[model samples]
Target: MTGLGWVGQVLTVEITGFAHGGLGVARHDGRVVFVRGALPDERVTARVVDDRKAAFCHAELVEVLTPSVHRIDPVCPAAAAGAGCCDLSFVTGSHGRELKSRALADQLRRIGGVDWEGVVEPIGSSDTDAPQVGWRTRVRLAVDADGRLGYHRHGSDEVIAQTDCAQPVAGLTDGLAGLGGLRPGTELVVSIDDAVGDAAPARQIVQIAAPSRGRGRQRRRPRTGPPRVIEGGPTTLRRVGERMWQVPVTGFWQAHRDAALVYSDVVTGWASTGAEVAVGWDLYGGVGVLAGALRDAGVAQVWTAEGDATATAVAVNSFADDSGVHPVTGSTETVVTGLPRPGVVVADPPRSGAGRAVVAAICAAGPDTVIHVGCDPAALARDLRLFAEHGYRVRDIRGFDAFPLTHHVEAIAVLNRDR
Candidate 1:
């Protein structure tokens, strides 16, 4: 299949195609396919970027012969113009909820190879389908040859620097565009909280990191640390109730304001299912955010652990201030394996998913209940299976539309020992 399907000429796609984030076709061979800047029921003209396989093609949108009713002005200009943010303006805002819900389901079946469909129910906003539009909180940008600030082209090394993002937290983007063109040999990172709202009190900011030239004899990579350069992102302290969390600008923090409250509420409510758990463990404790929640919820004797030093320090002080919550520092695998064995274990692991070590530890401990918080449904599904095979039973699985756009959804699963 090798032909423009019609070069530079527009084709009226019936708006019927998609298989996960990738494009798809029912059946066709020897044709160049183009998709992007497409809408339902609209005709579009595309430029072929690459043609391959029997029935697929890559394309760039040249024009829309007819736009779909669902199509609207993109909220992020970067979504339309920046390569890195290529999908920024994809579909209507409301479509975010819909697409993400499906994306989660699809990932489990297609990526994780789970045959069960609808094993998870998506919990969406009752008021709206999409999450907040802007103030992304953290952004990674590339520096141009002129040492100016900008973004990386969608698929190329090219730079498209900008001063403002539609999604930047308030006050943070100020002078951001101007900070480009550094003193030479350095990097830049920006962090903000949209929740603070404009004109509100300012929050804490650690410091930014400086970059180094790459592949040189003097160019040595910094040890794994916060994503930011200040030797790592500036130390950030987040207080949840009586617990204070020291997170780096580069470290993970819930993007939406009030989301932590929402998560904490859910975990506390779920924990009520059992009392006197054989053990109480918080995985991916990340400054013991959940552990703090456990303390507030009145759950005692939790072995809370985290990896980052700054985060762990925050954990120590946060829980130390309370005198009831306990904290440990190390990898989740090690923490889980060495635990004294409780009836309940709560974890919110990273996007890549949990590993065999954690799974084995869980199996070995054989807790009566397990609560898992995950961002990737596919990875979650895989880990769920591992837990199931080890004697834990998945009692319930539900999702939270955390990041409204960008094909991401978060989930929480409760597993029982059925004893």
Candidate 2:
């Protein structure tokens, strides 16, 4: 072992803490080491995979000589094998929430440059004793060259065949089993309509085609049977409260089952129904859920913009009864520029966050109250700084542990323009 290379060298190290991607971090010879499938305060034997001289290194867990008290047996085979789903499966619900809170705090302070001392309020997974199983309402399934349905392991293109996944809701996994006969190289996504009460009766599967070798465009089609085709309609309907929304089976929706209600409550509370809002905009709105909430709160006119054409069509249907709600189809940065100045603005951008151009435009419009919903803390931080530069200050910030047992978090920030 004296002069061995990094690949197969076994080294004993004590895990100090967890990193962003849920990997256990350790120190070896004054260098940082990241080990998959490890826990804090445990002594583990790790095999170095990538040795970056003196700066940091990546390693795979070979064996745990001493385990932490929080460690437990993983519920799913995929998570136990570290197959990309839940790397923090060993952590209990309460401890997992604690770790996520710390991660979010660090991101807000380090990336967003905001002094946030508040705790990450747990919304969906508040019960510390509740079992962390079957929380994921949406699951993406990948088909290998052999036409088998499974998921690609973390950081690798090779697919890992999985028979059972404990992360998705009860009925959703059963829906994935129905599409086992998909044609070779077919990619699929499964989502459960949990809004149908606890039973979650609707289980829909959609086939998503990857971009062609040289082309950058991809196509999505609902898959009922095996031989894949490029043409199909909406797979199922998702009910949020009294409204039913039509979405492609593979369309983007919250991964958490209770996310729809939870997010809506947070946004509404921050929006404050008491204030008289004549006109408001819900940017990056999907299926107009927030817009519908605003209209219910007595907003005279609510306009929503979504980048997806399919989601815009469904938004039109959801708000057909309410003439006050207007649906705009285009990217948020493009469409928001044309609309008249609104009393309030709500944006729930993707992980990349809203760029400077969009933020500048919103500032120019000068909305009295701006509601920013974000999934990435770093992106939120950067955008919050931009908002502050344009005479808007963060009035309130609340975080929800939407995605449990992982590093991901959903945050809400309410910004008020200075008069």
- Top-scoring candidate (lDDT): 2
Model 2 segments beyond 4 Å from truth? 1-10, 51-54, 121-126, 175-180, 195-200, 211-233
Highest TM-score: which candidate? 2
Clashes of 1: 25
Worst window of 10 by summed lDDT in candidate 2: 211-220
Task: Report residue 133 deviation for candidate 1 (angstroms).
Answer: 1.7
TM-scores of all candidate predictions against the true structure: 0.78, 0.87
Estimate every model's Cα lDDT from 0 to 1: 0.61, 0.77
Judged by whole-model lDDT over C-alpha atoms, candidate 1 comes out at 0.61
How high is the lDDT of residue 276 in model 1? Answer: 47
